[model samples]
Target: MRPCPSPLRPLLLGVAFAAISPTALLAQQTAPIVLDEITLQAATATGTIAAPAQPYAGGQVSTRTRLGALGDVDVQSAPFRAAAYTEELIRNQQARTLADVTRNDPSVRQDAPAFSERDSFFIRGFSVPNLDTLYDGLPYIANPRRSALEGIGRVDLLMGPTALANGGVGRVGGTINMIPKRAEDQDLTRVTTGIASDSQLWTHVDLGRRFGPRKEWGVRGNLSWRGGDTALDNNNAEVGVAALGLDYRGDALRATLDLNASKQDLDAPTSLFNAAAPGVPIPDAPDGDINTANPFEFHDSTHRMIAGRVEYDLAPATTVYGAFGASRYREDFLTSNYTITAPNGDAINELGFNPQEIEGRTAEIGLRTEATTGPVRHRITLSAAYALNRNNRGEFNPRLLGFPVAGTNIYDPVYLPAAPDLSGLPRADGLIPFADLRSRSVALSDTMSLDDDRVQLTFGGRWQEIRTRGFNTRPGIPDFPVGEQNYLYEDSAFTPAIAASWRIRDGLTVYGNYVEALTEGPMAPSVAENAGELFPAVVNRQREVGLKYDLGTVTLGASLFEIRQPNGITDPASNVFSLSGQQRNRGLELSAAGAPMEGLRILGGVTLMDAELRRTQDGAFDGNDVPGVPRTAASLYAEYDLPSVQGLTLNGRVMHGGSTWYDQANTQKVSGWTRLDLGARYAVEAQGREIELRANVENVLDESYWASSARGFLAAGAPRTYAVSASMKF
Candidate 1:
């Protein structure tokens, strides 16, 4: 039972105010229209501004999320489905952090980790390694870092086949591009402070300025710092991020240069617990509790990135755009007291020492152009890229301490005595430090519009080649025993899309589109020394059909999609050292967003999915559900503003996720759960400036469930939480 501000009173007062305000002002009165009105109308008609370009067809949500929209589409009139997490949305939602903002988007999901170092997420059912993340259109080559979502100007999430343009390195679900805040006219500064459920204090600041005669070239920057400890006894986190950018937009050409840097340190102390044996009932404590008796591991680490882009208009109708980005990352990671369950259901303990350091660099360059020649419209784009990554690991072993009870911090190291009792202890005899890889790709695409401009068609493809070389510092390391390992792998695939739109009536346009896209080749094998090592890549092919309806104030869409990954390479069930074969994901989605009624805004979406593994070395899994992928998911958000009040609004939302499997065996399952959130805001005028106050509560039902399950571990979901914030604008 959650209580929200009553909804009916605002509507009634709003209507009455709308009816009376105008007349009351008229009574106090003004001058009548005269000869001046005629001249004003004529001048206004001749000096009208051109509309912004239509955004390309498809969904684009982030600046770093490389979908065709970022470089190809006009942002003015194209009918594509997109949800921008703009500053206004962030403020209205009272989203205090980055993770908080993602909770509102139906297509994106975050899997909370019991231990902070376990890795967080902003994705759809895909194993996107943390190393693949990007910042301001550049890959963060260093260790990934988490930042406050508040300082972001906007976040773009481009969905579907648009993946083809991003060098094809992710899940088909979608891509996220976070556009940080840039400088604007007038000096602006903001400070935010908050507290989490774990009783940790958090604060961040953002500043922007545009000084000079015309403010043509401006400066923008942000600084965020946060530190806190969790309910889990030994866990804690510290993070800091700073960014600055310069912008110059002249009459004919525009350019921007920016720099971003961040550092994160986490004392992610985590405890490991084994589920009770098959015959024993699973233990259940109070609704929301952390397991503190288990022996734990502690993790400490740091990450950084530097990057920039330039755009020039060659002519009134033609423009050339190019971008160059480079980044480097270095990290030293270590783990202690790692534990796992043995086959017999007993707990096995090991000291996990990962005293390894990794450093790598990623670079890319690309060009784009578009123009219209009479009845024929053409768009052309070409890109060339090079990337290299290297990892050096040495003197690490995975056996050491005893496993403790749940949630506890206890260490019991294993020792070998005079008689050599080292049966289960890790051996330090064979250690290696070596693995380097390099890859390059070239892509070209052209889209032509014909048939009276109502019918549009596009055909594009990419040719990519990858070369790898690996070496081991130690002998007997399987594939590269005391020598260099080299391999050359190449792949070429074409992405073709066809879409059409018809103007059925005024203010209404209907459209449909179909796209065939593909992801690149295989991935590097895990760095585990072993035998019968098999490395194979996976291919994803998808076909989708959807309908979109737009009527100015409202937009509606529905899509049905099927994706098949033939020869999907995966780790073998028997050992984590080898690989195995195919999987498929098929689904349907429906969504709508708009201001259906005056002063009211709404966004709703639902998805029905079927994901599975078709075949494997173990046997045929034709009907088994894919692990970690939801069968059904839904979300809804609605807000209403009171017209009578200068600034007052109410907001509410609900999100739900259906059942999902936890592993390939399909023996463990997580049931569905629903969440509710509610909030409101009020504005006050003080000393000629306006200030807004907001309050919100999440998970009103206080439901307890597994928010995310991965590899073989599960993280508990957060319980009910409430927050309040205040902001001022000048």
Candidate 2:
């Protein structure tokens, strides 16, 4: 691990002072504040505006979520598989990003290097891009690579395609949505300070207040900063974040506005490695905390976003809502790529730099109405969504003997000399337009309730249109009109979904659903025989059946699902890319959450999947397991409050995955691994202020292993690391 720096002392001291000052100020006030009463009354109220659901008994997970157009629904009533992690869970675990919050989910696997600029995940045997994530029902605000959590209130994960719910242009795996924090009716002031392994230090402040008569106006703000050496040798990271939210509530109208800005810088970021040579045996993973990239290799990113929403009740049974959001993101990075050349950890490395910028806007409008027709109650919704994204990018690459850099051994790392000078090489000083995309969709849905709301049925459909154009941004290439570029792909599809749920008893529900999804097709690469050929959009079909039981304090769910989609592949002999194959994934999932006993809480599940490649180019790889998918995976997390010590809790988690193949032929493989994490938290009253301290250790066994194989590459699991934090509220 890297050594701590001298600057960390002042940051820690400042955090401590910030936390204590609030307490002193509160004491000086002439009127004593009754916090418990204010908090309880605010929590019990239900308003027209949407808010995150309360945490379960243990405060680790939530029972309700706003999933797509379904609005806020309890897990037991929704006819699908999903999970919502609450803000309380994030704070207790000190989670920094989405990856940290979803670590205990059995159906998801992260597919990126720990310190890399990008974060990717595979869900239910399919890849889910960060761009697909939504923020408050609008897409394009959450950064796919590294999204800050300071402004987020809840993280919700929905399994399966979201075409009917979120519209087209999504993956079959699922969708992730982040709900921004909103100010409550009560006043709050909190401060937190934390340190991680290898001397990383961080501090954050959160404040919320409601003003005006009847507390109709609310405001909340958060600010945070972290800088120091990371767990990896010679690697360091710095991050800064600021967020603000404002809202208004009235008898007929509700409105909210949110703004955020963040920046991240990493020195010596981890590099990605390709699969080993076909003939050579796969090499063992290197030390988990080793840094192989040169010190100069770094990544820097900045992002800004703003979003607002408003809802008005036209009548007691009718409502209208609208939302608009926009974001701008920029990234500059220089990194090395490594490829194993021999079984003994020999590899070749290359250096390159890329600078890119993206701007996007998204909007939504909807109307909902409810009525009762004699014995049947009906709820109907009509909505439309629109989004636009534009990207600009530039790169610099200097080749040496056909390779970007010299070769080195992975086991015994050796840093390369200074990068070759690129002054003579042609450089693109300014970014050029790379791609532009526009998406529009309209949806209609209805839910019918019968037998005093004991039986419910829902059906929906969406008409989606996607238009995309690409450009040749190469510096020396002859420039052409933006719309006249060689690549232009446009398509439209109408997808449908139907679901039904029956109440078997007071606490158990049985449900099933059939849904379809559509994804943009791939364009053949220039090297392919049918280069530039644009294929038709790919369609995915899914069917699922599940059972959910809510026993007051414990929730249990089980699901079985199957998803099938067309697979595109390149023929070796013809050098042509086409949709010549099919892929299918069938799986079963079991999950449980909430407190089973008075003091013991559990949140986790197991997933068993069978993913296969079928109808390949020549049937050569038919019946083979899909690359990067594990057959069996399980995760378990438990927390217990000690009866001997008030306000003291102990928690632990375990995760395991089965072996996975790296190639379609199944020749290269990575063994499965298990990891353990443990932590403890204690709360107490200090000087009339509530203070809490927490400490956690991940990878407690210090085992080094390969975490996953996705996109034909391997990622190393995180090493043993410690985190300690202290927070005070007034």
Best by lDDT: 2
Question: Please, what is the whole-model Cα lDDT of each candidate in the order they appear?
Answer: 0.51, 0.77
Badly placed stretches (over 4 Å) of model 2 are 1-13, 16-48, 395-403, 420-429, 475-484, 522-536, 568-580
- Writing each residue's lDDT as its tens digit, candidate 1 over 1-730 gives 1111224224423432432243322332123223332211111001001111222212212112234322524211133344555566776776645556666666556664434553445344554444544444444352443444544676555555444456544445555556656676668865444444565444455677876677667677765554566555445655555667667666445556666665545553443332322222222212333433222333444444454555555544334554445543433333333223332223343334433344555555555554445555555566665556555555322322232223222222232222223244322223344555455656676555555444455556655554444454444446755545533344445555554454455434454445444543434333223421323334456666566566556667676677666533333233344334465777777877667777788776887888777766667555677766787778888888888886898889999888776556676566677888888888766565455667777777887766655333345565576666555444
For model 2, how big is the CA root-mean-square deviation?
6.6
The C-alpha local distance difference test score for the whole of candidate 2 amounts to 0.77
Clashes of 2: 0
Candidate 2 lDDT over 1-730, as tens digits, reads: 2332335446645875565454543442123223442211111112226555778667777878766655677777888888889888889989988888877689998887787776778888887767778887678777747787888888889999887777455678888888888877668888888889887878888899988887889899988887788888778988888889999887678899999988888888886676444545667788878877888777777888999988887765567888889998888776777777787888877776657788888888887766666566667778898888777665322232243567887777788666544344432235666677778999998877789778999999888888877765443435554334656778888889898899889989999999987776665643355644566667789999999998989989999999998876454335566776887999999999999999899999999999999998689889999878999999999999999999999999999989987767778777888889999999888567778889999989987777777655678777889898888887
Error of 2 at 656 (Å): 0.8
